[model samples]
Target chain A: MKKITVGFLALLFLMTLGGCKKKEKVKVIPPAEKQVAKTGEEVKEKPIPKPVVQEESIEDMSLEEINKKGYLQRIHFDFDKYNIREDQKPILIKNAEWLKAHPTVKILIEGHCDERGTEEYNLALGEKRAKAVRDFLISLGISPDRIKIVSYGKSRPLDPRHNEEAWAKNRRAEFVIIAK
Target chain B: MRKILIFMFLSLFSFSQQEITIRIKGGIPAIRIAVPPFIVRATTQQAISAAKEIEEAFRADLAFSRVFDPLSRDLIALVKDRNPEKPDLKAWESVGASVVFIGKVEEKGEYLRFVGKLYDARSKNFILGKSFYGKIKYRRLMAHRMGDELLKYFGQVPIFTTKIAFISDRDGNRELYIMDYDGMNQMRLTYTKGMEMLPAWSHNGEMIAYTSFRKGNPDLYIRHIYQGRDELVARGGSNITPDFSPDDKFLLYSSSLPGNYEIYIYNLRTKQRRRLTFSYGSDLTPKWSPDEEKILFSSDRSGSPQLYIMDSDGKNPRRITFQGSYNASPDWAPDGDRIIYVSRVLGRFNLYMLFLSTSQVIKLTSGMAMNENPCFSPDGRHIVFSSNRSGKYQIYIMDYDGKNLRQLTSKGNNLMPSWQKINYRR
Candidate 1:
């Protein structure tokens, strides 16, 4: 019963957010109406410039440029482990929220590992790490289509140094904005 | 001229069949053999130097075999057999050589011909003689053929001519490269400009199945090395760790296409694939058994990565490693009695050999460095693996008993070495 109530409230909040976006679209159209009135009395209003303004609300950014925004957080894993840590839950929640806000943004989660195990096993372990993150995101209501995962094994390390500190950084699932 | 022709014909027919068979068993000692410097009968400078190079390469192959005790340079200097056709066997025997090899390299226009004669020093009998003809550029290959001939005569698999395919980042990217068993002629095999890893050489040695990231994702690719063509085997969702079947008609690998990493077997001829494992845990590094009846793979279904064995059809799955919590990269030896794998204990990765019959596990390496991806040699006498004991990862070869360890590569971070598999008749 309490779960239903919470879900109902969440749906109401999403509806309210959608209502605000519609209001913003309404506000942008008045300027386009003023431009149409100034252009010609007999010309038909194409509304082409208005839709562009609304599309510009999300910012027409390249994949690399959008990824530089660092909206989604990279989650780190323990050595030789794929389970999400309790301390890292808050970071994933924030990332999930950001992903929820940007529904059209597609992400590629690259799972990585430390340079300890063999390449083949590490590749599998990296996939497990990525899947674990994807599962967590799914629990938080992120669509599966919005996220794709790849395991780089230990080939691409954030830090090339052979130490625990560097390994902790290397064993992470990095989020890349693939499409928007 | 007629006398010379007759002498040549007689020497060619002088090979005798020895009654005693030399088997390289555990208790038997390595046969003492003397290899005199090859007689160079070449007029050109290239051919003269090629003769000397071939001699050294052939001797190195013998030393690397670990089955023959090659005579030292000092012992070989004690006897000089100027005419390879007329070797002084008694002088070779005086230097404690049980067998002697007299080799002659002759340059014929654009090709080189190597004539090698093996003799029993005590009995003064020609045991066997072989002639290898090839271009001057294939000097090492011809030398390896001579070594292979000696190995075959002793009822052993010819491993001197086999190659080891591995991943090297020396060219700034991890690319597939193959080298001689002793690390000579390191040649890059792929120019995909993307990371290539986990190369598995086919049993016939005509193809190499490896994982590449050339298309932005790790995809399985089979490179027909000699033909200079590639066939994209699998794609979509991180395809990696391709192991060719014994007959080269199929490939077994792990892919993340079905929501998670799962073992899949694909028919190379028909291009059909079937999932072997249906588990949430990752199933990776699948290798075919010698007879192709079973498969040896690593799985994390039991909470941690462990070695697992199942039938070729993915039935009767069972875990084999219980001692270590982290056991992966299991390779079935050609003998079918032992398995070589990597196990991590207290963060240190080392190679371990498990006996399937007795269930006895022996540690093959002991160090603080990471020793991983160990594959058995074609003859199952040696293991090729990667290690970072020298501060950088390099390929190394060691005997099955863990002695006589030698480094095969010394370039930028070579890992995941797959020794070529050659089938031998029992």
Candidate 2:
């Protein structure tokens, strides 16, 4: 039940945020009243349509709408492992939904490794972790085209201390907005 | 007068102190005592054994242990009236010798003969000496034999003439190449159009094992240079970084067979492949310890890349680097005390060395160009690595201290250098 709720929230959040985007509206108005004809004629008022708000429909809204808003998301793995657990799917799905809502937005998924193995192996391992998240997104009906993934490979850490909690946070995938 | 006396004392103090360096053989100190010449019957074919040349080599080779005590001897006097085949003990004892080395050298037109002997002053018996044969190029072998003689005299193993097989892009692309201890006369052993990279010379040096990315996927292959042929070793997956065991009977490599890169060990004799790492994170680049008891590799189990080491049986895996934000591709030193790796600092890559116990970090290379792959020479006195310092990627050699830089290749962009281990096989 929690997984389904988390997944629904992620889908909704992704739909609303849409990551990163930019837009601007320009307005030009004709002179309120043309100068009255100098030949002793009264000035005349021009009629103008009252400005009305019209919803601007957009097909690709995943990336742009989410740029202004930020998210704090985390995925956990078992000790000495990098696979995303079943408990973390709903959490990730929530973020994916927001991405789908705003197509213009782009996101970066950073994969990390714990401090268990050699540094090189950890780097490659981190890459695999990040790639795992990428594949999951595509599986969730999220287009792979909107996401960029990179592995820190055990270089970056959420906690510097050597302990279970620190490693748990270290073995995670993070999402960041790259463009709007 | 007082000032002069103080000055004399300081001068004597400075002169009394000496700075010396000696080589270690099998991590043990070998003494470097000079052995002079010995006189033998000039007409005999076996006149010279462990001759003067071998004596010098013995002294030098013993110094490798960093534990030799030099005793200067006069070759002319030792051999002037003595026959090395049988020598009087009294003459050598008169010199207050802890040990005495006596040898004879005979010259016959274009041919030569050598006989050598080592005597223990305490036992009054021959400790070492043997006859040998070889040409000028193999003269070093004669010295090495004397080294063996000295070691066996002290109950130690002798290591020389071992082969080192490493990946060199000196010719064009990264390919398997072999060379002597000093990186001299390197021969290109692989001639495939595709890259035969990360060549790890088998512990025996007779076969070179590496990852060939031919056929669009990485595969492990072992080649015996003399026969000009190779054998496939892995079952499937992009197998790379194949490091052989100390006995050359097994190999440790990285494979992505199960949809993610992981570590595996393949027994050469048994033809069985064993998976070593099962973490969800991909594990790659496994290096065997000097004793083949541990494996070192890189992983992203953390958020970023770091260096890690595990046991030969894939147990008790621990992280080795904490200071660096990025560290990978660690090559263990033959002496088993130091590990050289590539560390990324501020978006730039360079070579680094970490002392095992102290973890004292030493940056070996610093330049604008990327200095990624580093390999230690067989003697551990020098290292060769790939660098772009010359505006192009090329192989460069430098002293272990990062001095005396020399460009080994000037053409083509060469990279991914893997130094072959060649200190004991021969």
Candidate 3:
């Protein structure tokens, strides 16, 4: 009876140790998997799958819904500049691909500016921004006839705050689906 | 020193009899004048009120000229008689005034008659006198006419009869409005729900050409202001910043039709459009030279926006501004000797005047909130621009050399001021 009690105690101790080891393994493996998931998200953010996701979401959604879902991303410009930045190229490519997937769609490109310049000059600058986007899409095999450009200049602002961040956001080109 | 003082006194006395001739010999000092309360010939309250308003309008007009120093009301009250045909010249001269303007208003049924006379205080004789008859509502116009006659006697251009057309968002939408040069008689000229901007008055002051987004696109429009009729001059692409030719036979504008903003001129009679610029960059805000032979416009063809001058035929496009990376909204002076424009320096916009003959640029505004859309007054000696220095965008008028800055607007975002050429016949 004494030997059997000692054996039971030993068995209980071993079982507790095993449970702790399992908990340790769980804690260890999760961070590694989290790292992998983070890297995977970074990989997904590349040019390849972005348009596919955009296309899938855009097909079933209305124009307002698409806009609400942010399927078409607004592209930003530098101060007093209309040239698209290199980092924005991939996004434009994704937009172009999405536009291509929907053959019957028409888009209007609205160019905007921060309230830092004269209204008339900003109008010209905004037009240039819209044209830059349209030209890029055209180069990516999208039809020019499907796109129309308008310059709101500094009249419309995405963010009304008077600061650098707000100005950066205000100076952007936005796409609105006119027809589908 | 006594001898020198005596000699100066003698010289001054020699020219005292010919004050007008002496005033013209050197830089004319602002003439000191007295404008007392006008005499009301009618007994009714409304008639008396109308006379008071006429006097006030006349005083404001003279003050706006910046060439007259109107005596204080306190000084004018010391005069015993304020009659237009009476002996107040001695009282005015005692107050250091060299000229005196006296006026009387009479109510004649539906019309008011205003008679104003300018007197040389030293001569105690009438220098000039004029009478104006107009509807009761045109009392201000009558006063302006009187002021113009006074200005003519001083060899200064009369601007009180001019008008200013500007863009205002007071009605929850940007629209064009015309007001008297002193900001009285504000009238809504365009009811288009969309944005209307960049108003340019025709040379004859009969029409106003502006850019409107009424049809969901920026297009050029010309309206016969008095006739209440408008026509679309250009559409289909971004057409903006329209200016009438000196002869009022053509409209110069900028369009983005060829996938880029370029200057274009459209003939009013034939409706023929001619492209003036073919650069890859944007060219906009074209202003006709006084002679209508050259066009001064802002162009970004050289990688940064700068002022450029091209012939009326769109030939020989040459850059005129090189000091700033951003220079735009060029208005050629009516005298055809200078150009006024806005330039961006250290991220703040300010007005600069370029003397065409010398290619010299002078900064007219400094440390004031962003000043822009500068247009020369009809005389080319003053400029009207919009500034936010007062914490809100308002139209301001300053001398050509940036003196006597006066705010012309106080409500809403008043911008893009276009001074109308005076039509004396009107």
Candidate 4:
């Protein structure tokens, strides 16, 4: 798993420069320039130094450890809407910060809905809500495999009442520490 | 499938084969039952009415249950009211009562307390033991409780504690009214001065999805029953018959969004709406199957009102009914084999059933007034429907096979009953 992740990260980094390297090599092949650059390369040939960047891949992180450190946050969404908004970016960032700070951590987001419609609709709605949170996390450099999402729809409501306050409270997405 | 079904069916077949000493196959057609008036144990003035009122409540309850032919109160009326322990069992038997009821009452402060029992006349066995203690204002509730217990005694689901959500004009305008399943305990669920109808209950029992005409068009609104909180769920064209899925995850309902009425599914998670039908005629009154594999709905798509079924994903559509000239509002039994719907066979619209496996159609109701909107109990053994058989629109419940026909309410025009699921907490 570690080797595959390393290979995948390397591939992603290579894909980023694959296009620019072709033009650079073509321009450097002024044969005349290559000979001079070759002489310079020989002078500097302690070894061709590989560029290094401190990029942390989520694969190495243990969710159980992060959970033990108490760094989990729930992502909330507007009613019936699963698309994450710009305003909610900071919330995801905070979660990302916690995840990035505490490696080897994993999180699960359980999606819920207010009792406004049928159960099937709520389940689908809950799925979309949790998926939206997961997608947003992935875009923020969090590995897709790091987050696990499940939907409870309107069944596991936080408030079991027939009131506005109760409904609002029930329509939510909850984050739980699955592994750290 | 065959072997599994045979095993399952044999298990069901074995239970209904209960031994009967005295054959109940014949006689005057009325189910022989005896609800003997309660003899008050209390020696007080209020006890006289307290026990009698509870008895009267059960009388109405059982009589409407259609499961029992309550023994004549007149015969018991002449026997002279007395203390609880002094009833002559022989007197009840003489009146051809096959079953009997006995009770006693007490006064605890301003409240009334009562305990009762149902005795099988033939077996001479106590079938049910019921007790109650409540204020005078709650006598009816006490009575409903007794009635509900009586129903359970005879293998009937107690619907007295259940409720009905229907549209009514008692307030001079059509608004959503929630009443006891027996048509008592009436309260207004929606009082916006707008018309609300076709109320459907959420499986979790907290919310109600209904059609509200407050915006001058039929729109779906989800309203909390207790707090009276409501949110507009879906808008546009005549939206009606919102039925919740088994898991309460999605809504299957009818809307005229595509020029004519068609069933649609609205996913609460994704806020994505998908149209389920695009037929040429009106498709309305969509009911979810117990397993949520299919939906039973009424559609004029094939000409007059007829029942149709389609997969939960709106594929593989087919007609499940073909008998009656008109059939509408079909609710699938909890077991998912049979469908109960309102059908007009000989001019009167009454409850009927269509067996999906054998294509056998059973007309559960016939004659008298119009019966509409048959909602099955959570156990699927009974169905509560609306009818005008008792001179006014009132609610009635009957076994799924249409054996017991009992009137629930006689007070006002009550229509469209929605049965709540069994109280899981209790």
| DockQ for all models | 0.49, 0.19, 0.48, 0.01
Off-target runs (Cα >4 Å) in candidate 3 are: A1-70, B1-28, B74-83, B88-95, B423-426
How far residue B64's Cα lies from its native spot in candidate 3, in Å, is: 1.2
Q: How accurate locally is residue B186 in candidate 2, as Cα lDDT from 0 to 100?
A: 62
Can you tell me the DockQ of model 2?
A: 0.19
Model with the higher TM-score, candidate 1 or 4: 1
Per-residue lDDT of B166 in model 4: 69
Q: Which ten residues in a row have the lowest lDDT in candidate 3 chain A?
A: A46-55
Instruction: In angstroms, give how far residue B291 of model 1 lies from its true place.
Output: 2.4
lDDT of each: 0.87, 0.65, 0.83, 0.69
> Which digits, one per residue and each the tens of the lDDT, describe model 1 over residues A1-180?
999999999999999999999999988657756766787666553655424343433456777777787888888999888999998999999999888888888888889999987787788788888889999999999999998888898889999888989999999999998878
Tens digits of per-residue lDDT, candidate 3, B331-366, equal 987767789999999888899999877888999999
Off-target runs (Cα >4 Å) in candidate 4 are: A1-180, B1-33, B41-50, B73-100, B118-128, B202-206, B246-250, B266-281, B324-326, B333-338, B342-352, B362-426
Tens digit per residue, CA lDDT, model 3, A1-180: 999999999999999999999999987646544776777755443233324343365667787876676556899999999999998999999999888887888999999999888888899889889999999999999999999989989978898666789999999999988777
Weakest ten-residue segment in model 4 chain B by summed lDDT: B1-10
Listed per model in order, the count of residue pairs whose N, CA or C atoms clash below 3 Å is 0, 78, 0, 30
Model 2 off-target regions past 4 Å? A1-180, B1-30, B35-114, B119-126, B135-137, B151-157, B214-216, B235-237, B280-282, B290-293, B333-338, B346-426
Whole-model alpha-carbon lDDT for candidate 2: 0.65
- Preferred candidate (DockQ higher): 1 or 2: 1
Using lDDT as the yardstick, the better of models 1 and 3 is: 1
Q: lDDT tens string, model 2, B86-117? A: 55655555554556667655555444445667
lDDT of 4 by residue, B1-426 (tens): 111111112222234563212122332224566555555655567766766777677777776654566667676665454344544555666777776677666777678887877676666666677788999778778888877787666555476666667666666666777766655677777677765677888777777888776864558888877777986778864577888887777887877556556789988567677998888866777887765688887776676678888888888888877786667778887656778887766455677788777788888888766677788876565788877676666778777657666776555456667887542213
Superposed by TM-score, candidate 4 places the C-alpha of residue B59 at a distance from the truth, in angstroms, of: 1.9
Q: Would you estimate the TM-scores of all the predictions?
A: 0.83, 0.54, 0.81, 0.55
